[model samples]
Target: MLRLFLRKYRTMILASVFFFYLGCCLTINFTRIECAFKTSSKNELETRVQSLSKAQYVVIILSSPNNEPKRDAIRATWGNFVNNIFVENGEIINKWNHTRISKQSQQNVVKLLFVVGTLGLSGTKADKLGNEQKRYKDFLILENVEDSYKNLSLKLLNALSWISENLKDMKYVIKCDDDSFVRIDLIVKDLDAFAPSMNAPKLNKFVTFKEHLPTYKGLYWGYFNGHAEVFLTGKWQEKGWFLCDNYLPYALGGGYVISRRIVDYIAQNMDFLSSYNAEDVSMGVWTASLNAINRVHDVRFDTEWKSRGCKDNMLIRHKQTTSDMFQMYKSLAQSNGEKLCNTEELHRKTYFYSWNVLPSSCCKRN
Candidate 1:
């Protein structure tokens, strides 16, 4: 009887082993089938790329309301700057004001894409345009809010959604405030030289910020005065102000670039927060959470004309008066203080000579 039982047990074990091997074989086959599907999909993508035009186009979305003279003025300012300095002249850079969506002239564009918001749409032209534009599945609008933080947050979320839907075909997306002025020529040249490797996976290149706060419980609040607003709820006691710790890094506002992938990720994950004020900081935290590297490029991110103290030489300047903008552009055109305006040119020359370009080693004391 004992011998018969041992033989039966061995037979059962063999059957179990045979079935496990069969299951493993089936799984391996299915994996290969899935991989083949992916390869075919990749080939399809390659075919599409081969057929499409390969031109680098910069898309600038300037948010403004309708019939505002400022919108036209901003357009003029951008048009003049882009025409004079940028490499891809006429039709290469498409600048669209958010206010003119409803006009008969704008119907074609609104059909393609549209964004709506208070700052984005002002009068009848804008309202009609926005209403019509919203019919499209891709159209996005700013979140309605009475405060600056919520308003800007909604604006950014809308922009991110638009970018994700469009980035596959776009070369670059530049998001700037209405008040910000760009040196398009310099920007194009810089991007041309620094465009991340086409061979490697897409890289996330943008200005990153680091912030550090103290360990003290109550003493740690109320440090950030650069831009801070009150919260609607008292969930947390209103301490002094929260300071971006001296050691902690955080991205600065006024706007920054995001790679297509990063934009896609943000669009899918941006949650509605009640009290977060700094959009740039929020973006930095989000990107870092995804393990994406946030590159801190040395290009001057933001500057005011009046505060041009010693660092007048900057690639980009923000919050400049109209008169100051004229002066700065005129200075660049005239070669006054050659160092300030011609840094990009100088770097190009130095690069051509095969000499090492030194990193900019300067910091503004807050």
Candidate 2:
């Protein structure tokens, strides 16, 4: 009787093992199939979506559906004000066909877009976003990806893909968060001086002069310096392991401008590039992977919780609320809108810490 019981127990264990292996095989197959489906869906969407034509520079504001007030605030203040003008005829024409009123149109070369992602399969959130898009006709929606913090990298890729496909002619593409406020007058003045004509000279070529030198074609301008470590665990860790120990020298995600060349490179390599959930860091990785990209540092793009002292000189200020945007615009107006603000603190490096995982070397306070 003991021998019979032992044989029966062995048979049951064998059956369980067989079933578990089969389940694993099925799960693996299902995941592959799901990934394939998602890839196809994204490809289809990419093909069907239309691109915005014209515009020398495109300022893409990464926003959400619920942030209508913030969007409106931007439009009311800096959004509506184009190139230091306050609007005489209430109509300024640029390449993107954005029919809005602002100050005098110096070059009328900048275009604004708010990018948002889908909420779910079918719900009020999705509906609200659709309605908002239709009403404004300014948002670029990511149908394949969900709108969540973890999926920001994918959202950024979607934007890059669209821009590459559609806005290829635009000289520079500035990726900004909804909360970040840009002094358009400053940006336009810089772009104009750097790349004034179609054959504008390319700046920032030498190794020693990258810090204060102006850049033109093939330039990746932002507030970033050396590499930061990729955390394998905790809040900062998601898919960071795909990258090496340190993230590549890329711009901060809050606000950075990528030249047409980088955008083209990103568009071409989107399929094979590993997706790290952190958009800014992932962008650094992407640029680092490519050999031809010219990564130039400009401290004018501020991404700090507490900004530096050069308020007037800031080209872009992150972590702004609607109220904050209004106040900044007012300040800009008072400071003689067109005169380039002092870059006294422009070269000063600012440090930001969201988690304690980052090393002292990641961001050096100077």
Best by TM-score: 2
User: Which candidate number would show the highest lDDT if scored against the true structure?
Assistant: 2
lDDT of 1 by residue, 237-310 (tens): 32333533221223344434555556666677766432244455455455544442324333355532223322
lDDT of the candidates, in the order given: 0.41, 0.66
Residue-level lDDT for 61 in candidate 2 = 85
Listed per model in order, the count of residue pairs whose N, CA or C atoms clash below 3 Å is: 16, 4
Total clashing pairs in model 1: 16
Worst 10 residues of 2 by lDDT: 204-213
Worst 10-residue lDDT window for candidate 1 reads 216-225
